[model samples]
Target chain A: MSQKSEGGLQEQVAQLYGTYVDMVYRIAVLYLKEPAAAEDAVQEVFVKLMHWLARGRLQEKEHIKRWLIVTTKTTCMDELRRQKRQSTDPIEAGDFCSLPAVWQSGQGPDGERLREVHDALMRLSEDCRLVMYLFYFEGYSSAEIAGMLHMNHSTVRGKLRTGRRRMRILLEEDRE
Target chain B: MRQEDIREYFRSQGPSETQKDRILAGVLEQYEQETQGEFHMCTKTKRSVSKIVAIAAVMVLTTVSAFAAVPEFRDWIGGQFGLTAEQEADLAASGTLQNIQASASNGNLTMTVHQALVDEQGMYIIYDVDSDDGSAVDVSLDDLQFQASESAGVFLYSIEQKVLETREDGVTCMALLTGLEDLSGQEVSLSSCGLTCRWTVGETAEIQKIEADLTGKDLWTGRPYHVTGCGLSPICVKLDLDGAERLQDSGFPDQVAVEVANTDGSVKTIQSVGSCGKETEDYRYQMFLFDEIIDVDRVQAVYVDGVKLN
Candidate 1:
């Protein structure tokens, strides 16, 4: 490759990482729950982005973002499956300390509330957690989330409802 | 916790800048390593070609009025599809590259098939779509249709369309179509909108293609399946699975990783060209196209789901 093309590639990759790294990491966290594993998934997803951009298959920015989300989910699912095969025990949310240091230490103003919410989220199933994350945090409609996650629309809605009810119960138990 | 709190909590959990930077650096390093490996493979292929063919390749590159489109097509193949120099030379010397400046106009857009290179495995066509008023124009595989002569029994297994460039007046695109049968010497026709064009498939140079019987083969998904056969081509890998009755699009095992173990003791996982799958009757067929035309001779083995097929 020429210096010019290599420079172009660097620029393209940096642009992609800058634009979507956070989104990819967030989605991976919803699926993987472990920060280190999520970070690894981020690398895999971006490597895919580099290959796609090099091939000129990525059409527009929106499409690229869509592809990244789907790829991240798939990568995390693969990792989860590998984990399942290696060990009979499933990866529970509490198996690892997924709470951030700030939330765990309760240092910020609403740190305790944030930690409670995190615990409640960790209690939900991965799919339910992902649907809730996309709907509430990402501001995606149920239909759009369904399309991105490859789930039926009704399933997405049901997951959202189930997640909300379960989290409410967990949070209420904490108050009591 | 309230929904607002839940959203805010997860929002704050995004990775830190240090973590993002570390992941980005790792990805860039991986890309560079893969790119260097490909560079070495190309260099090795060039060195292995016969000197006579190399000389003839040079001659054709410099002075071939009959092959006016060879240089442009060669550069496009090299730049976009990353064909090795030896592969490009073989295509030219074997008379497989065809220069067809055939054009057809529909409404305000004129579509011209600039050049085409065909082999028994697949066909690569370079074309241009021009708008009458220098407006933006685009063309996709869905907008076009292909038909081969009935005697050839050539069915398109998969097709990919890529826009090479978007000039002010129009866009240049490349369409790669892999087939289930031999395409060489078969007259194939294409139609988009109301315009139609035809071209005879050219003779191809010797290329490595592995045909394997996939009876009772299991995919990485561990599903009991019966694939009719497998074709390992220079540009793509074609797979036909029988008894895929009532399988939805999502049910097709698209993520079965295709890896090429090259003769150089390096394994290259084919990525990014994306795959196309078609369901006909009780069959699910797929073609995994490479971003570049690979030198299949360099591939020592082709593996799907860790099972070595060739």
Candidate 2:
């Protein structure tokens, strides 16, 4: 490759890295629940991107972004799966019910609600949790979620519906 | 309880500035480290390729008996032409050949000749040949003329050998012709500014095999390649090996087809891969093609055909 072309590609990569680093890291943190793991996941995503660029594989910018998100999601999922496999016992029902200290320290109604929502989210199935994150946090539509997850739109919509219903029920029961 | 209420609550509880700054800083630092490692790896690959070329050149210069007498002369020739020893040996073996290799850099073409066969009478006759292994080949042609074909928008050549290399702007082609005893029965004709000639002899179906090692690269990500004149609308085809589907898009009017055929006879066809939008730098919409199916060990190969459109 010519020096000019190589330099331009490097610049584009650096710019893209700067643009999506936050999104990637947040996705990782949400999935992994550990800041250090999230940091590693973000690094892994960028490393993969750099490899793609060097190999002349990354053709377009939008495609590159989509790839990074999907990869980050998958990597996070795989880490979760591995953790699940390593543990002999499944997480009990009360695992997510236990509130963090901050929530119980005489916080406001919003803080209590946030804790409830967070607990309810943790009780959800992995797929439902991912759908909720993509929808609520990532601002992805059902169609975009389906594309990102490689699932049918109807399937994602169903997951979203079921997740919302479960969360609502959990919160209502807490109110009672 | 309402969806809007939930959204409003979450928005109101948005991450604090400190949290956002910490997350962003961590991410940036990680990305920088990763990018540095990748740059190091790429430099290593280039160095390895250069080393292989150097070793091959040394082996050829030391072992070849025919070119031993003219050591200084050979060195001079090698230095003047930037020919490695292996490249020189291949050229010595092939009497006449033509080849082209193209690569894309800033929307321009970088062409290099690996081999050529020069005609004794005119030195302009060229025959581009295909090698079993897709690497640079040696040619015997001395004088060559290169001109761009208006019809095909590809570079064409008139050499001593009766071969034509069809190359895109940024690709390189190499031809090697060995055991050139007689030049009879071989005919060279220039129909279009680009050689509209067909392969008269040898294999009728030249299956150009391309192997992409995407082991480390994330397969879920979409990658787009410009495939013109595929004759059919882009249809994603699944290969037999793994049921992974890949997106295929036909740029403009040309049909683009991505098919995966495995030895096991399993086949999967990917639907619409992704949407296409106008590129940031150009007016052309960048197409998004991705492998929809996942959890596979690996992908063997991907074939894109633009022959029908041509």
Candidate 3:
């Protein structure tokens, strides 16, 4: 890029940095759970965006948004993988149970019941958990999730079915 | 059990409006910042009609009239700045031009200018900042004025006409300033959108505050803008009490010592818990505290007493 173009890109980046720093941090916090790691993830994503812009990519606003989320998810997964490799200690079970239960209409089960459901969901594999999150929490359809995660539609459907079944069983156990 | 049940549960957990506003502001700002360069570039190319026609006329006239005929042109114009072919094409397409303002400071003084035009195809003004040393420079917009109709957010400004037109862009009303080239480079660059310009003068000053605070009912969005605080460190539980005493007193095994480790390898201990009861046999307990606030959906692991329960 020409020096002038480079300067322009820098100005835009400064603007973006001013605007989105917090949102990126929040997303990172949501995924990484470690403040340091979340900050690192957010910074890394922006740096990556800068690099891409320098390379003449990141063509649109939607592209940038998608890049942020996808990169954050990947960063979180990378952190998880690194911890898994270095540590021999068993992983903690569900922390969702630690939260107090409060219920409102249109909200699913009460907190206690939800915790039970979450605990059961935790028992499933990580892939299953992710599929469930994308489908349920994110309000993504199986097809949409398949595209986002780059998985087969059938596989996404199967995972959703299995996840739902497992959750039902767990909820039933809670009732019992 | 049902999808509705799950949806309700999740909806109940949705972030509060304040949090959403903060997040959305950040998201929108990032989006705007990232794309603004291209937008400016496109705008610049579109608005440079007179310059383009002049340049083209000069190029054609020089070829036909002979280079020597325009000898005084070099002295009269000093130099000719022509857009690259790609830039020209981009200009033809977008039909818009944007001017940016900036400020610079020497040790004893500061000067501001609205320097460059940009178009969608990505072009900008270049100057040698280091040509004169001991001078620091910052760029901003000034005297950004706009008017909006009752509806529409489309802002139209004619740099040559000195007219500002504002219209609705869907839901938001946009303010537009035209004929910005008439303003000094410094003022144009430092101009703020949506509100009055607040300039702070000092030796070590940074930004000239341009308050873009939305008015009246628009404040329902919760402050036209807000900054998100830094992420918090995960909460830690310290177990300083003797496990043996509590476990023995509670009829629990002293051999069972509980340890907690975060994903980052930071460790803590869980002391004074009784021995595994009958219920412990059927159900396992894994305690994992997040190192920071997180969306519940994004939480990947929760460890309990140093066990990979998840």
Error of 1 at A42 (Å): 0.5
Worst 10 residues of 3 chain B by lDDT: B69-78
Give per-residue CA lDDT, model 3, range B10-121, as digits (tens): 4444333344333323432353354442222111223222233333333333333221110111110011124332232122112112212234544333332222222111
Residue-level error in angstroms, candidate 3, position B108: 47
- For each candidate in turn, the TM-score is 0.45, 0.39, 0.33
Question: DockQ numbers for every candidate?
Answer: 0.14, 0.05, 0.05
Candidate 1 has what TM-score? Answer: 0.45
Off by over 4 Å in 3: A1-43, A50-56, A88-90, A96-109, B8-310
How close to the true structure is residue B180 of candidate 2, measured as C-alpha lDDT?
Answer: 23
The DockQ value obtained for model 3 is 0.05
> Which residues of candidate 2, in runs, are more than 4 Å off?
A1-14, A59-61, A85-106, B4-310
Candidate 3 structure lDDT: 0.37
Give the alpha-carbon lDDT of every model: 0.65, 0.41, 0.37
Which candidate number would show the highest lDDT if scored against the true structure? 1
Which candidate comes out best when scored by TM-score? Answer: 1
What are the candidates' C-alpha RMSDs? 22.0, 22.6, 26.0
